[model samples]
Target chain A: MLSIKNLHASVEGTPILKGINLEVKAGEVHAIMGPNGSGKSTLASVLAGREEYEVTEGEVSFKSKDLLDLSPEDRAREGVFLAFQYPVEIPGVSSTNFLRTAVNQVREYRGLEPLDAVKFLSLMKEKMKLVEIDQKLLSRSLNEGFSGGEKKRNEIFQMAMLEPTLSILDETDSGLDIDALRIVSNGVNQLKSDNNATIVVTHYQRLLDYIVPDFVHVLYNGKIVKSGTKELAMELEEKGYDWIKEEADKATV
Target chain B: MTTITKDNITDSLLATVHPNGNSEAAQVIRENGFPTTKHEEYKFTNITKRIESKIQSFQQAKPLGLTQQDVSKAMIKDLDADVVVFNNGQFSAELSSLGEGYAVTNVTNSEAPFSIKDLYDDSYLALNKASFEKGVFIQVPKNKVLDKPVLLLNLVKANDGQLITPKLWIDCAENTEAVFIEQTVSQDEQAYLLNGSVEIKTASNSHIHYYRVQNQNNEALEVNNLLTDIHRDSTFTSFVLSLEGDMIRNNVTLNLLDSGCEGNMYGLYLLGGKTHVDNHTNVDHTKPHSESNELYKGVLADTSRGVFNGKIFVREDAQKTNAFQQNNNILLSDEATINTKPQLEIWADDVKCSHGCTTGQLDEEALFYLQARGIDKKQGKALLLYAFAGDVLEHLKIEAFKEYCIDLVQKKLGTNF
Candidate 1:
C-alpha cells in the first residue's frame, strides 16, 4: 500500500534522513523502532508533508500515487494520516468541529456527500467509545488543556474518525500511561482491517504487546539496519539499541 | 486643510437652531478650538485633519428614503431582537419595533431634558452637542429584565458631505438588565462624517451589555464617544467591533462611580486597506473595592493602521481596586502598523493594578497545525485568526451576535472557515 525509495530528507539544510527505504503491504502492520534522533519522527513528519522538512531526494508512493507531489492537506485527503507525537492545541475550535471539517473534507475529496449534524454526531459517539473519551471533551477546544494521555487518546479518536488507509502512529506511546496505552492501542487494533495499513513508530516495545506487529525493523542513523519479526522488538528492549548501533557501524565500515 | 474656527462652527449651528442646554458646550468648543494634534488626547487621532480634509459644513444631510434593497442591507435577518432603524440620523418609527420596557422618543418632542454635563468640554462630545439635529432617548424602567436585545441600526445613505451626529441616552434603572446594540453602516461609498455620542447611566445593581459595531464603507469617517457611568453593584460589559471605515475613532470612558461595581471593555478591530481605527478607553475607579478589566485586540492587514490606548485610574479614595488592561495586535503585512499603549495610574496604595501590550504576527506553528489537518491555507489562516480573537468573542452572551461577529471576521479575512 505504500513505498519509500532512498528517502533523503533534511530540515534547514541539516540532513536527518539519509538513504532510507521501506515498503508496507495492505492488511499488514509494521513496527519501526529506534532510539532518540534516529529519524523515526522525521519519517512521520515527512510523510505528513510538514513543509519545514525538505525531501531533497526521495520517492514516496501511496496506493500507486506520487505522494511527494501532494500538499499536506492533499495527502490527508488521499487517505494518509499521521498521529502526531505531540498534538497541537487549537483553541476556540472544538474537537467535534475539527473532526467534522476534516471528515467532510476527506469525504468531499472522495466524491462523497458531506455528513449532516445528526449523522456526524452518531459517528462521533460510536468512535468515542473506542478510546473511552468523554462526550464533554469533544465539545471543548481541540487538545487545549488536555492531559498527555488524553491527547494521545484524542489522536486515536481522530484516526478512527478519519479512517485513513495508511496510518503512521509516530511515537504515539510516548506520554501515555499503562492504562491509556492499553486503551489507545486497543482502539488502533480495533480499527485494523484487510484494506488498511498501519505503521507503529516507537522508541520502546511496551506498546507492541497490545497491538502486535507483523514485522519489526530497527532504525539506526536514519536507515533500517535489521528487519525481523515481533521477537525483534523484545530483543531490542532487552538488549538495548547500543548493539544495533554497533552493528550499523560495522555495516558502514 | 482649511482651519475650522470656533466662530465658524458655532455660527453654522446657531444659524440652524440653538437647542437648549448647549451653550456651555459651545463655549467649551470655543475655548478648546477643536483639538489639534498638539493635544495629548488627540495625538494619534487627529479629528481636526479628519473633519477639515473631507467635510465642509456640519449641517444635517438631506434625509433619503430607504428602498426594499436598503432594508435588506440595514437589518440583520433571523436575529431575534427588537430593532430600531434610523434613516440619515433620524429615527424611523415605521421601521422600528421597540418592545416593552423600552420608551423610545425623539429628543425634540421628549419633554425630559437631554444633556451631557461632564463631557461638555471634550471636542467630540461638544461637537455632537452643538450640531446634533436628530437624536433618540431610550429608557428602560427599574427592576425589569429585557426579554431581548434592542438593536439600534444607524444607516447612512450616500453622502453629499453630510455630518450625521446621532446622539443616544440610555438610562437603565436600578436592578435592570438589558443588552443594547448600536450598528453603524453606510449604504454607499460616500465620504460622509458620522460624529456620534452615547451616554448610558446605569443605576445600582443593574447589568448592561452594550455592543457597538462600526461596519461603515471604506470612504466613511466616524468618531464615536461613549460615556458610561456605572453605579454601585452594577456590571457594565461593552464590546466594540470595528470592521471597516476610512477613519474610525472610538473614545470610551467608563467610570466606576460607586463601590462594588464591575466594568469590562473588550474590542476587536479587523482592519485592511488604508483603514485606520483608534480606540481610546479610560476606566476610572472612583469608589473603593471596584474592579475593571480591559482588552482590545486588532488585526491590521495591508497598510491599515490601528491605535489602542487603554488607561486605568485608581483614585485616592478607591482602596482595594483591581484593574487590568491588555492590548494585543497582529500585523499581517510588513506595512501594517499598530501603536498600543497601556497606562495605569494608582493613587491608592492598596490596589492591584496591571497592564500589558503586545504586537506581533500570527503563530506559524499554529497555522501549520491547522493546515496539516486537511484544512487549506486560507481556511487555516482564518482558523488561527478566529482563535486569536476567541477570548473576546467568547465573552459575548448573545449567540446571534457572536455568530454575526464570526461572519464579519471571516469576511474581513477573505475566507470562511
Candidate 2:
C-alpha cells in the first residue's frame, strides 16, 4: 500500500508536480494517464528518490514508513521499485553479475539469505521465459547493445526477479512493439498478488488494454483532474485531452 | 664530484664514463650526455629530475646479510634454466640453476668474445655496465623451445641500507621461443634505491614474453631501463605493473629491426599516498612490414602523481608498419596529478600509425549504473575502476603475474570487501 498527500516536487527550481494526492491499496493496478509534461515521470522519479528533484512540500508514505528519508539505494532496498524509462547501459559488467549482486544486496538488507548461483540461474530462467527474453542477452554486458524491446523486456524480467511490494512502470511500453508489450504486460500481470500494488504510468491507453487497471486518473498541468473507472481511459483516448482541459478549466473557474 | 651538480648531471655523468671496451654502445654514452630533459627522446618523463638530485657514487649494492643460503634458495627456484637472482643487487649464485643451453658467466672484462651485440649508446646500459658488481647472461640455443616460463625474482630486503644496480642480458637464438618474468619485490618497508638495466635480443622468427612486477616497498625507489630488439618475424611483449614505491621509473624500448616483426608493450600502475610512478615506452619501427602496439593505464589517489609517456617512430624505410599507442589515467583525488603524452613520428608515407592519451576520474555514467543496483558507493567505484584497467591486467600473460595484479587491486580496495 502507498499514499501520496499533495506531492509538490520540482526539478532545478521549476515546479513539475504542483499537487498530487493518490492512494493505492493492495491487489490493485492503478493507471495514471497524462499528456506530455504532466509530471508522471517526476512522480516516479521522486518516489524512487532521484537526487535531482526538490520536494518543497509533501509527504509520501510507503508501507506506513516515510520514503523521503531513504536514499535511492536505500529506497530500492525498501521494496520501492521503479522500472526505469531508459535503462542504463553498464559496460564490462555482465547482466547476470549485475542482477545477482542487486538481488543479494536487497536480500542482505532485509536480513534474508542470499540465493546461490544454482538457484539464481533457475529463477532467471523461469523469469526470462515468462518475459519471452533470450538467455544469451542475459549473459552479455548489461544492456550495452540491447534492442529497444529487449531492454523493456529485461526491465520486466528484473521486476519479476526482485518481486517488489510496489512496482511503478514509467512508460515501459513506449518503444515496445505489440508482441513485446503483450509479453511484458502479461509478465507483470502474472507477478501481481493480493499483498502488492502496481502503478502503470503512460501517455496512451493501448497498454491499458492488456493490463486492465482498477482506477484510471487523468493528470494535466501537474494535478490529477479526473478519476473514474476503467471507462475513463477509453473516454480520454477517444475524445483526446481537450475534454479534460475543459473540465479542468470549469473546475478552476 | 665537481662535475655532479643537478643542473648539468647528464653531461657530468656521461662525461665521466670510462668506456675502453669494444662496445660502441658504451663509447656513445661517454660522448653524449645521459638522458636529460633537453633530449627530445626523454622529454616527457623528466628522469633527470630524480637522477640529478641524487649524486652519490655509483657503487655496487652492499647489504648486511648476503649469505650463501640466499644464493642456494635462488638456485632452487630456477633449477632447470639459466637464471641469476639478485638480492639487493648482489647475484646469488649459490641459489642459481644453470642449464646446458646457457653459460652463466660474470663480465670479468668488458671486451669478451661474445656473440651478444650492444648496438645502441643508451646511457643507462653504459651506467649499468660501469657500476654493477655482477651481471647475468641467459642464452637459448637456435631452434630451441623453452617449455617453462623463467622466473627471475629480484628481491630488495627491508631496512637494508643498500643501493642496488642490476644488469641483465638475454639472447634467444634463431627460431627459438621463451617467456621471461622478472619480478621486483621487497621484503621490508625500508628506504633504498635500485638502478637497473635489462637488454634482450630476439633472433629471427623467435618470440618472447617478458613480465615485470615492480611492487617495491613503499619506502623504496626504483629506476629501470629495459631495451628489446626484435628480428625478422620475431615477436616480443612486455608487461609492467607498479604497485608501491616513492619514486619508480620504467623505461621500455622496442626496436623492430627487421621486416614482419611484431612488438607489444602494456602496463598498469596503481598508486596512493604520495606515490610517484612514471612509465616511458618507445616503439621504433626500423624496417618495413613491422607492427607495434602500446597501452598504459594508471589510477592515482591521495596526492599521488602518475606520468605516462608513449612514443612511436616509423623510419623512412619502414613502409606498411602499423603502430598504435594509447595512455589513459584516472586521478581519484583533486591533488592527484597525472601527466600523459602519446607522441608519434612517422617518416614513412605508407604507414598506419595512431596514438591517443587521456586523464580523468571514474566514468560517472558507469558509476551511477552500479550504484543503482544497490551496490555501495565505495565498491561501485572500485569495480568500475578495476574494469577500466582490466585490459592491462589481462595482457600480463603469465598466470601468477595476472593473479598478483588482481590481488593487488583487491587489497587496494581494503576492508570494503
Candidate 3:
C-alpha cells in the first residue's frame, strides 16, 4: 500500500531524514521507534506533505501514485491521513463544523455525494461513541481549551469519520493517559481491515502493547538501522536505544 | 454655485446654510477652517483632501427621483421594523412607514430636547450643524418599549459633486428600551460627500442598542459623527460594520453621565481595493461605578487601509470604573496597512482600565491545520478569517441582523459556507 525508496528530506536546509527505505503492505501495521531527535516525527511530517519539509532525494509512492506530487489537502483526499503531534487550537471553528467540511471534501474527491445535515449528525453520533468524545466538546471551538486526552480522542474521531486508506499516528500516545490510550487503540483496532494500512510512529513500545504491530523498525540518525518483529520492541523496551546506537556506530566505522 | 476649492470649501458650504443653523458652529468652522494632516486627530486621515477633490461642483442638486423599489432593494428582507427612508438628505415621508409607541417629527419644526454642547469641537460636527437642512427627531416615551426596532435607511443618489448632510436625534426616555439600525447605502457611481450626525439620549434606567452599517459605493466619501449621552443606570451598546466605502470616517463618542452605567462599542471593517475606513471611539466615565468595553477588528485586502483609535477616560469622581479596549487587525496584502492605537487615561486610582492593540497576518499554522483536514487553500483561508471575525459578530442580539451581517461578511470574503 505504501513504499519509500531511499527517501531523503530536510527542513530549512538541514537534513533530517536520510536514505530511509520502508515498505508496508495492506492489512499490516508498521511501528517506527526511536529516541529523541532520531527523525521519527520528521518521517511522519514528510509523509504528510508538510510544506516546510523539502524532499531532497528519492521518491515515495502510495497506491502506486506519486505521493510527493500532491498537496497536503490532496494527500488527505487520496486516503492519506496524519494525526498531528500537536493539534492547533482554532478559536472560532467548532469541531463539528471542521469535521463536516473535512468529510464533505473528502467525499467529493472520491466522487461521492455529500451527506446532508441529518445524516451527518447521525454519523457523528455513532463515531462519538467509538471515541468516547462528548457532543458538547465538539460544539465548542476546535481544541481551544480541550484537555490532552480530549484532543487525542478528537483526532481519532476525525480519523474514523474520514476513513483514510493509510493512517499515520505520530506520537498519539505521548500525551494520553492509560484510559485514553486504551480508547484510542480500540478505535484504531476496530477500523482496521484487509485493504488498509497504519504506521505507528512513537518513542516507546508502550503503545505497541495495545495495538500490536506486524513489524518494528528502529530509526537512528535519520536512517532506519534495524528492522525486526514485535519481539524486537520488547527487547528494546527492556534495554534502550544505546545498544542499537553502538551497533549502528560500529557498522558505520 | 461657486467652485468649491480646498481654500473656499467651508465658505461654499456655509453660503446656502439652513435658516435654523447655529451661528457659533459656523463661526468655529470659519475660524479653524477644515483640518489638515498636521492636526493631531486627522493625522492619518486626509479628509480635507478627499472632500476637496470630490466637492468641486457642490450644489443643491434636485433629488434623483428615487422610488419605492430602490428603497425596498436596500432594505433587509423579512425585517419587521419601523422604516424611515432619507433620500439625498431629505426625509421621504411617502416612503417611510411608522408603527406604534414612537413619534417621528422634523427637527426643523420642533425644539431639540437635548443640547449638542459637548460635541461641538470637531470640524465635521460644525459642518453638519451649519448646513443640515432636513433632520429627523425620533422620540420614545418613558417606560415604553417599542414593539420593533427603528430602521433609519439613508439612501444617497448623487452622481455629481453634491454635499448631503443627514442628521438624526433619538430621545429615549427613562425606563425605555429601544434598538436603532442606521444603515447608509449609495445609489450612484460618481463622487459625492455625505456629512452625517446622530445624537442619542438614553435617560436613567434605559437601554439602547445602536447599529451603524456603512455599505456605500466606491465614490462616496462619508463622515459620520455619533454622540451618545448615557444617563444613570443605563446601558448603551453600539456596533459599526463597514464593508464598502471610498473614504469613511466614523467618530463615536459615549458619555456615561451618572452612576452604574455601562457602554459597549464593537466594530468590524472588511475592506479591499483603495477603500479607507477609520473608526475613532471615545468612552467617558464621569460618575462612579461605570464600565465600558470596546473591541474593533479589521481585515484589509489589496491596498486598503484601516485606522482604529480607541480612548477610555476615567475621571477623578468616576471611582470603581472598569474599562477595557482591544483592537486587532489582519493585513492580507503586503501593501495593506492598519494604524491602531488604544489609549486609556485613568485619573482615578481605584479604576480598572486596560487597552491593547495587535496587527498581523493570519496564523500560518492554523491555516495549514484546516488545509490538512481536506479543505482547499482558499476555503481554509476564508474559514480562518471568518473565525477571526466571529468574536465581533457574536455580540449582535438580533438574530436576523446577525445573520444579515454574517452573509455580508461571507460575501465580502468570498466564502461559500
> Which of the numbered candidates is closest to the native, going by highest TM-score?
3
In candidate 1, what are the lDDT values of residues B1-417, reduced to their tens digit?
Answer: 123564465454334333553666667766776666788877877766766666665566666777646755676656688877777777777777779866987775223245544532676677776666667888888898999998888878645536787778889899999998888768778787787888899999999999988876887888888889999999999999988888888888898999999999999999888889999888999999999988888888988899998888899999999998888888998998898888788899999998898888977776666666677777777777877876788888888888888788778775421
Model 2 chain B: weakest 10-residue lDDT segment is B111-120
Question: Against the hidden reference, what TM-scores do the models get?
Answer: 0.89, 0.87, 0.95
RMSD versus native structure for model 1: 3.5
Ranking by lDDT: 3, 1, 2
lDDT of 3 by residue, A53-168 (tens): 99999999999999999988998999988888898999999999989998999999999999999999999999889989999999999999999988989888999999999999
Instruction: Assess chain B of each prediction and give its TM-score.
Output: 0.92, 0.84, 0.96
Query: In candidate 1, how many clashes are counted?
Result: 0
> Candidates' lDDT values, in order?
0.84, 0.77, 0.87
Clashing pairs in 1: none
Comparison by TM-score, 2 against 3, better one: 3
Interface RMSD of each: 1.3, 1.9, 0.8
Candidate 3's C-alpha runs over 4 A off are A250-253, B1-6, B12-16, B109-114, B415-417
As for TM-score, the candidate ahead, 1 or 2, is 1
**Candidate with more favorable, higher DockQ: 2 or 3:** 3
CAPRI level of candidate 2:
acceptable
Which model scores highest in lDDT? 3
lDDT of 1 by residue, A1-253 (tens): 8999999999999999997889999999999999899999999999989989999998999999999999888888888888989898887888888788888888898899999999999999999999999999889999999999999999999989988999999999997889999999999999999999999999889989998999999888888889999999999989998998998899899
Q: Any idea what lDDT model 3 has?
A: 0.87
